[model samples]
Target chain A: MATITRVGDPADPRVDDYRDLTTADRRPDRPGGRGLVIAEGVVVVRRLIESPYPVRSLLGVPRRLDELTDDLAALPVPAFSTSAETMAEVVGFHLNRGVLAVADRAAPPDVTALLRDARLVAVLEGVGDHENLGALFRNAAALGVDAVLLGPRCSDPLYRRSVRVSMGHVLRVPFAELPGPWPASMALLRAAGLRVAALTPAAGALPLASAGLAGERVALLLGAEGPGLTDEALDAADVRVRIPMAAGVDSLNVATAAAVAFYGLGCA
Target chain B: MATITRVGDPADPRVDDYRDLTTADRRPDRPGGRGLVIAEGVVVVRRLIESPYPVRSLLGVPRRLDELTDDLAALPVPAFSTSAETMAEVVGFHLNRGVLAVADRAAPPDVTALLRDARLVAVLEGVGDHENLGALFRNAAALGVDAVLLGPRCSDPLYRRSVRVSMGHVLRVPFAELPGPWPASMALLRAAGLRVAALTPAAGALPLASAGLAGERVALLLGAEGPGLTDEALDAADVRVRIPMAAGVDSLNVATAAAVAFYGLGCA
Candidate 1:
């Protein structure tokens, strides 16, 4: 069972981890940053409780804390209960979802360990946008992709926006930064017996479904939506697959396209 | 050719349509509404120029206006050039992409016309979120989806946020409200000889790929992420298809699911 404590003062030290949240948890790369993982709302908080990260504490309204009773019973942690007004004051904004959980970041897994048991994985290059990274993890989790390997120019998945946008799937999906060098590092997947397939909107690329990828151990490479796969990244793939889009239409959002490709490759 | 006009002051009467854009345009459906269709950024502005909606005028920085010179050449409307700072004052927000266009909405095409030409159409129920609706249109356009048919609890696609999020694809995608009673209104598509298939995650629903949807004319029925399609709507469909998601996960975003289904049914 977890300890439940009532906190009324907005400046209470017990809830220091939850204070002025907006400025306090700015990305570690930003100034005045602590980079703690903040999960909002009941669903994401539940996920945070279940995630591998060590829980520091929780702050929420009584009603939301009441809703997490079953989850709280399974974990040993301190949960601070307060009114919505105090939570808004301390968090520096009105969090409509009513509850929040903050956890320390865990060291990311190694690329080799991440791909060890994975049959399908996503290889991302230049996916620097936070929401796109979060959405990609959400898609990867839902579509049966076993792991995610981050390439150069990708944003930190633990960024608050990415964590929230991913619905905490970033906490569930194992991800690792590729170690060696750009494009060359991708050869590691090939050596592990996974075929490297790059997704591009290039006209000559074979249609995704017709690329002979169904049920194959595959790593699907994707670039950010606008400036697609860097030339070197495209050259590294064993095969290039296209989604066969309409003329004059721009490419689909990076995460949305990744979902389609993930579904096609995983279901195959 | 468009009449070139130089506007030196933010308070100029000619730019009234673009004034207080953030506040005035947001509640266009409320009591003091001006139901104007506004398009922002270069890409969307270009789409607005080509859409059936009548372009009233243009407000842009000289650089943005100059980039649209060819597009302006074919239009007889006023093209007002001003500094970014002046444009910001009128809009009450920093205008990135630096251009804005206002168009008057035209009567949507008849539903029968949509059904006659469309091989695949999307019918949305309770997709009240504008960004989801807009992103759906972008995907629909890319996947060669014919038209979008709105059912109920939807948002106005002409909203500024929707326009920007859809990358102006809303201007290109043809959508109209389905007439008659709620779910029963769907019968109109069947009456037009299109198969109405609902996408859901419930057991007993055929897996999308194996549902034998390819080469068949399909009108995909989608609902909001949480409530999804109502029992009435599900029962009305000729068949229910599921995307075969991993267990314990929520459904895919309605638009993303629609794209995968659209692709499965063969966009061409």
Candidate 2:
């Protein structure tokens, strides 16, 4: 069972990991950044407990902490109970969700290992927005996409904002950076028997519905919202598919477009 | 042609429509609310100019206004060019997109007229989040969803934030409130020769892939993210279709779910 501790002081050293959270270097690549995985709210905190990340501790209001009693009993970690006000002071913001969990980042799964037996996967290029990257992971998880392979210019999926936006699915969905040069690294997916299908809005590309990729192993390559896929990435794909959009309408948000692709391709 | 006016005063009464924008009564329904539609940034401002809504005027930095010169040249409205600092003073915030446009709301399209040739439509219930609603309209426009019918508990899509988030597509898509009672209001869709398909994540719901809704005239019923459709709303549907999500995962964002359904059934 987890130990329950009352932390009345906002400056308590026990809760130092939770200090100045809004300004902390949550970025994965910054110098001196610890890349601590922070999960906010009861839902995401519960997911953190179930995730492979090593749970550092949890700080939450009494009500929220009580709600997670069953899950807390199974884990051996300290649970800090505090008032909503002190919790706000410690976290540097008023988190309406009332519960938070912090964890250490875990090593990503090997690309080869993640690809073994994987059928539907997402290959992201230039998905730099944290929320978009996070929402894509949530979509990937729900739609049965086996894993996510981050290409160049993708944001860290474990960014605090991303973790919150994804509802902690970033913790559930295994993601690893695609190593080596940009488009060249995508060849590894082909070697693993997954067809590289790039998603573009270009009129010349085949419509997603008629791409004939259903029931076949596909790595749906997605780009950022405005600029879309880089030319090299589009050229690298074995097949280029478009979503068949209306004329004069701009492209869909990167994450929303990814969801549509994930569903159409995964169902096939 | 729009008359260009250089506004040197931050407190100019002529720009009252753009004053204290961050806290203004942008809500259309509230008393004392002018229900003025606000479009921010160069892109959305341009869209506002082209929309059915009557363009009131334009307030922008010289550069953003210069980009819209061609569009503005045909409009008979005042264009106020001001310094960025003065614009910030009037708007109560630093306007990053550097342009703002205000318009008077136009009458909604007649429901029966809108459904005449709309092969794919969205029927929303309780989609109170402005961003989700806006993103849904953006997706609807992109995926060729012909129209949207709002049911009970829906927010006003013409709200300023929705206009911006929709990438001004809300200005393009035709949406009107579904008249009559709550679930019973949905009957109007069937009478118009459209199938009422409610999207739920329940176990017994038919998987979207196998529901055979493609290419059929479908009015996809969507509820908000958390509670989803009410019992009456679900029963009122001609069919209950699910997006085939992985177990243990929560539902997709209502807008994203609607996009997947739109693509699946719209292309059918």
Candidate 3:
């Protein structure tokens, strides 16, 4: 069971991990940065506790903490109970959801092992927006995509905004950076008996319904909303598919497009 | 051609329609409200010019107005050219998009006429969030949904936030409020030769892929994220279909789920 500690002072060093969180988690890979995985609100904090990442501690108001009694029962970390005002002071902003949990980042899963038994995967390229990346993870989790592979220029799925936007599915979904040079690294998916299907908005691309991808073990390559998949990435894929669109419409948001492809490609 | 006039002062009465837009557009239906339709950014501004809504005038920085020269060539409204600082002062915030357009709200298309020739449609219930409402329109446009019917508790699609978040697709996709009492109003869709398919996460609901709705005229019923379609709404539908989801995960965002259903039901 977790230990409960009352923290009245916002400056206490024991609660330092929860201080100035907006900037603290921005670039954890840089010097003097702590790469802590943060989960905000009661629901996400519960997910952080249930995730593979090692939970360090928790901070919340009394009422918010009471709501998580069952989730904290088996958690061995220290739970800091504080006033909403003090909690807001420590976090550098007021959080409407009240409860929060922080964890240490875990090593990503091996790509080869992750793909060996996977049926459906999402490989993202240049998805630099944290919210889009996070929303994609949430969609991936809901749609039953077996795993996610981060290609070149993709945002860190573990980033704070990404974690919150994904509703903590970033913790539930296993993701790893696709190592090696750009499009060349995608060969790993081909070797694992998965077809590499790139999603694009090009007029000549096969419509998703007619692409014959349903029920196939496929890796869907998606790109950012505006630029779309680079020519090299599209060329490397076994097939290029598009969602049939109305004339004069630009395209769907990247995450929304992924959900459509995930459903169309038989992820469910 | 638009009449370009130099406006050096922030308090110019000619630009009253574009003043303090954030609050002015909030409750346009209330007393003392102008009830204007606002479009932000060059892309959305161009859409406003092309839409049925009568463009009243435009407020923009020189650079952004210059970018819209071709769009403004046929427009007869006043174009107020101002510095970025003056534009920000009038709008009550920093206007990063550098352009704004206001138009008179046109009468909504008749619901019967909108449904008559529509092949695929989306009917929304309790979707009060402007961003979600807007995003759903963007998805609807991209996925080829022919029309949208706003049910009870739906936010105004012409609301400024919805217009911007939809990338102005709200202007492109035809929509109207489903008039009459509650779920009973849905009978109009049935009379129009369309199936009323309510989208839910119920376990017993038929999977979207297996629902056999592809190429069939469907009016997909969607609700807000948390409390999905009311029981009364669910009971009124011809069928209840769901995007197959992984166990332990909550439902997809309402707009995202709609996109998945739109694609799965063969809007593409």
Every prediction: chain A TM-score:
0.97, 0.97, 0.97
Q: In candidate 2, what are the lDDT values of residues A146-229, reduced to their tens digit?
A: 999999999889989999889899999999999889899997898899989999999989988788887789988999999999
* lDDT tens per residue, model 3, A193-258: 998999999998998878877777999999999999999999999999998887999988999999
- Summed over model 2, clashes come to 4
lDDT of each: 0.88, 0.90, 0.92
Clashing pairs in 1: A215-A268
- Per-residue lDDT tens digits for candidate 1, residues A224-267, read 98999999999989999999888889999999999989888876
Worst 10 residues of 2 chain B by lDDT: B23-32
Clashes of each: 1, 4, 0
- Each candidate's interface RMSD (Å, one decimal) is 1.4, 0.8, 1.5
TM value for model 2 = 0.97
Angstrom error at residue B145, model 3: 1.1
For candidate 1, write residues B1-268 as lDDT tens digits.
8897989899999999988876666655675457788899999999999999999999999999999999999899999999999999888889888999998888988999889868899999999888998899899889888899999888887787888888888889899999999988988998888889999988889988878777778889999888999999999999999988877677788888888877777732
Off by over 4 Å in 1: A27-29, B26-29
Ranked by DockQ from best down, the candidates are: 2, 3, 1
